[model samples]
Target: MIPVPTGARVWLATGYTDMRRGFPWLALQVQEVLRKGPLSGHLFVFRGRRSDLVKMIWHDGQGACLFTKRLERGRFIWPSVAGEAVTISPAQLSYLLSGIDWRNPARKPASDAGRIAAFTV
Candidate 1:
């Protein structure tokens, strides 16, 4: 579970079960919750009922931060609607935002470093 620093307002939407069953309407959901509430300067998270589509919206005073992620191989595990909010680790968020596979890991070598040998071996 990722702990958002205290004093930062974080709202998680884990209503996937209900959302799926109710045929969640994105426009209506955003309007009713995001538009009406003090969403400004707050972090909002949403997950698709079936797919691995996770959407996040946040207002950082200057502008809104919108984040979305889709897993290419496997579907992300979603929380039960009965739960209050699913906790995500900061590391997980970073990986998800960067389009890196959090499940399967790989790293690329640095390409900017100069060659070690002055002349070709």
Candidate 2:
């Protein structure tokens, strides 16, 4: 996981994004469409049209960093397109990267009762 600063905010861009574009274009999108400064030290996340790919951009004061992730089995969970963007906690970003449902992250039942018992000991 990237080490986000203590007060840094994560912003998710609503709708699909063209993954082909790099950080330069994405930074432009954040400034023009989202109406936020790209270099404001906040993380901006974008999901591709296919929903399997996700890209994130952040300006960490000294430089700009771009990160991307692709899921082999499932798509990344994204918010409905009700607005230009939505802010999520860093913990939710971790869940989103893991291809888990960030909205409702309930624990799943253990696959083996014995395994659970063994770990509890």
Candidate 3:
């Protein structure tokens, strides 16, 4: 999940689905969806019913890029399924997408130069 640009909104789809299955039928027609625009440049995020797998689709001028990730031991930290679309900061999205414990309150201590040097050896 990436942050939508300022003044720009992302239409995130929570349900996991075969994006290809829907893109061909729904990409061109955008009247009923959350954000209506040409599918060529927008970010589309999808998750499985279990919230374990995530897939993203985007078009970067020249071609489309697809990204997918599956967790080995846990599920993706998904937002509450209350609204069709929600605004999120770039930092929150990054943490959620990276499989980090976003809900944890404790922060990991930053490693000092001594620790870094030890690892380099």
Candidate 4:
């Protein structure tokens, strides 16, 4: 698992982003559109319109890092709203990348009756 430093924020850019955009362009989106600095050491995540691809950009004091993930089967779960930013924990991010719904994760080991509650991802 990727470790997240204490107090570091993970920002998810709601809706879709153009996957063709590289660091500089995506950084610009973070700064201008998200109203946040790209080099601010905070994690910024972007998802493509197809919902199967996601790109993450972050500055780790040394340099910028970009991570991309694409699902071979199901599409990535995303917020339905547009033009908004949501903050998530590193653990939730891990769940999201695992192709599981990060919002209402499955409750394990106790009962077989499956019930889920909706929450923002």
Candidate 5:
């Protein structure tokens, strides 16, 4: 998980963005298109047109950071609202990154008789 500041807010840019854009251009979009300060310490996330990739930009006071993620199977869920941006919590971002439905996460059963779960590094 990202070490986001406790008070920092996350904003999802509505619609899709060009994934080829770098930090400077994305920062410009955050300023001119979203009407938000790129250096405000808030994190701004943008999804690619294909919906499988996402780009994030944040100013961590000391320097600018650009993060990108691509799903191996499912596409990242997005809002269809006709707005410039939407605000979400850091927890929701984590859920979204994990390919889960951040909008309404369903409960899973505690007992898994047929399946086995394991983690390896």
Candidate 6:
């Protein structure tokens, strides 16, 4: 899990992005396109054109860190249109990274309701 600073926000860049871009390019996007400073310490998430991979960039005081995740069996959920970033909670980010639908983070039971674990019961 990526640790979020005290009150820093997570901004998801809407639409698809070219994953070929590196830190410098992505950072510039944060400033020019997203209209936010890359060094502001806010987490920025960008999805690839195929929606199966995503890149996250954030400044961790000393320097910037870039993290990437690709799903093997499912595509990452993302908004359709472009423009304006989406702010999501850290918990939602966790859901997203785990290949779950972050837009509506929910867990589905792995077994029948009648077979509930004795401990959970």
The residue-by-residue lDDT of candidate 2 on 1-121, one tens digit each, is 9888999999999999999999999999999999999999999999999999999999999999999999999898899874589999999999999999999998987677547453453
- Highest TM-score: which candidate? 2
- Give TM per candidate: 0.48, 0.90, 0.61, 0.85, 0.89, 0.88
Better of 2 and 6 by TM-score: 2
Pull out the clashing pairs in model 3.
16-47
Off by over 4 Å in 5: 110-121
Assess candidate 3 and give its lDDT. 0.57
Candidate 6, residues 15-38, lDDT tens digits: the string is 888999989999999999999999
Candidate 5 residue-wise lDDT, 1-121, digit = tens: 7777989999999898989999999999999989999999999999999899999999999999999999999999999874589999999999989989999978788778758979799
Model 4's TM-score against the true structure: 0.85
Model 1: CA > 4 A from native: 1-6, 17-38, 83-121
**Worst ten in a row by lDDT for model 3:** 22-31
Clashing pairs in 5: none
lDDT of each: 0.54, 0.93, 0.57, 0.88, 0.92, 0.91
Report the lDDT tens digits of candidate 3 across residue range 1-121. 5435555444456444554444443444333554555454666666677777777665556765567777777888765663365444455557667777555525678768437453453
Number of the top lDDT candidate = 2
Q: Let me know the TM-score candidate 6 reaches against the reference structure.
A: 0.88
Prediction-by-prediction clash tally: 0, 0, 1, 0, 0, 0
What lDDT, from 0 to 1, does candidate 1 have?
0.54
Q: Which RMSD values do the candidates have, in order?
A: 7.7, 3.6, 4.7, 8.7, 3.8, 4.1
